[model samples]
Target: MDSAPIVVHPPTGSGGRRVTVRGEILGLAHSDADVVEFLRRAGLPDAEGLLDDSAWVKWRGGRAHHYEAA
Candidate 1:
């Protein structure tokens, strides 16, 4: 399988997930909009659309849209 370019790491104690693109750490995201904004700042176009595209984003240690740690 092809690896995704963006990775949304598991939520931290503060309920924020770490967003990374191409191995570069973007920032902590508390919501989908935050993720999109991070991507936008990283010079990515159509970042909102990328959130749902599995080929573009890989959500690890939790489900997509889930920010609270279990």
Candidate 2:
């Protein structure tokens, strides 16, 4: 099994609840670059302030995408 870890920091001054976000991606059915590109295309920014744990991962010819949070 292959797993990757990502970290994110929630935005401030958004008038919402604040929280620290940490994500663990396990068993991605593709290369790390592909998975990262997929996440990036799905509006998951590669910056702090984006929800790292709650992002879409599209796989299998872009037919399936799952959202996971931790």
Candidate 3:
């Protein structure tokens, strides 16, 4: 199977940022909005705070990603 893609967003001050890319899991995430929520629940850094400095980072040809939590 393919790994899930990671989306990074800069901080927004509210502590929650934005998910740049969506994941694979439908219940977990498959769209931008769903990805954002998934990260939030995953205990990852708040997306709102990372919105201004985050973005959709992907490999050259790979869909999966490894994000450095800020």
**Candidate number achieving the greatest TM-score relative to the actual structure:** 1
Candidate 2 residues lying further than 4 Å off, grouped into runs, are 1-29, 47-70
Q: Local distance difference test, per candidate?
A: 0.90, 0.31, 0.40
Clashing pairs in 2: none
Model 1 off-target regions past 4 Å? Answer: none
Compose the digit string of candidate 3's lDDT tens values, residues 1-70.
1133454344334333344345532232333455446656756557444433424343222232323222
Give the Cα error of residue 58 in candidate 2, in Å.
13
- Tell me each candidate's TM-score: 0.90, 0.26, 0.29
Model 1 alpha-carbon miss at residue 50, Å? 0.8
Better of 2 and 3 by TM-score: 3
The alpha-carbon lDDT assigned to residue 58 of candidate 3 equals 32
Highest-lDDT candidate: 1
| Candidate 2 TM-score over all chains jointly | 0.26
Model 1 C-alpha lDDT versus the unseen true structure: 0.90
Worst 10 residues of 3 by lDDT: 60-69
Count of residue pairs whose backbone atoms collide, per candidate: 0, 0, 22
